[model samples]
Target: MIEPVELIGLAAGFLTAFSTVPQSIRIIRVRQAAAVSAGTYFMLLGSYILWLVYGIIQGAISIIFWNVIGIILGAAVLIMKLFIWKD
Candidate 1:
């Protein structure tokens, strides 16, 4: 049985991970990565990495999985912003 804290973490992770979908879609569809901040994404990626490591250490699969996905998405956005931005 999952504890309440685990369940809460799972829900929060799911929400945060899924919430990026729309922004990602918008960036892709419009091909406008100008509004994306590389610094912010990098910071987010770093934070996620830490969270993932912590999750692994604590045996919290929810945090580990969500942070893994978040890292990927965050990297993708940063890369896209770097390559696609005209300025």
Candidate 2:
């Protein structure tokens, strides 16, 4: 059984991981990528990657799991910005 604190942490991580979804959905729905900032995406991607590596080094499953999702979402957003949604 997960401890209460761990569960709370997991829930928070899940929320943070999923926080990228709305913008992704909006970008898909509106098909607008030009408004998205490449700099922001790059920063997010770098941050997620760093977190992923840190998780791996520390054997942190929660960090790994959430960061992987973050990477996917970040990649999608970057892809959309670079290829699919280019103005």
- Best-matching candidate per lDDT: 2
Q: Give the range of the ten consecutive residues with the poorest summed lDDT in model 1.
A: 15-24
Tens digit of per-residue lDDT, candidate 2, span 6-83: 989999888867777887899999979777897888888898999999999999999999999998988888888888
Q: Which stretches of candidate 1 lie over 4 Å from their true place?
A: 1-5
* Candidate 2, run of 10 with poorest lDDT: 15-24
TM-score versus the correct structure, for each prediction: 0.81, 0.88
**Model 1 TM-score, 2 decimals:** 0.81
Which residue runs of candidate 2 sit more than 4 Å off their true CA positions?
none
After the best TM-score superposition of candidate 1, give how far the Cα of residue 64 lies from its true spot, in angstroms: 0.9
Model 2 residue 77 lDDT score: 82
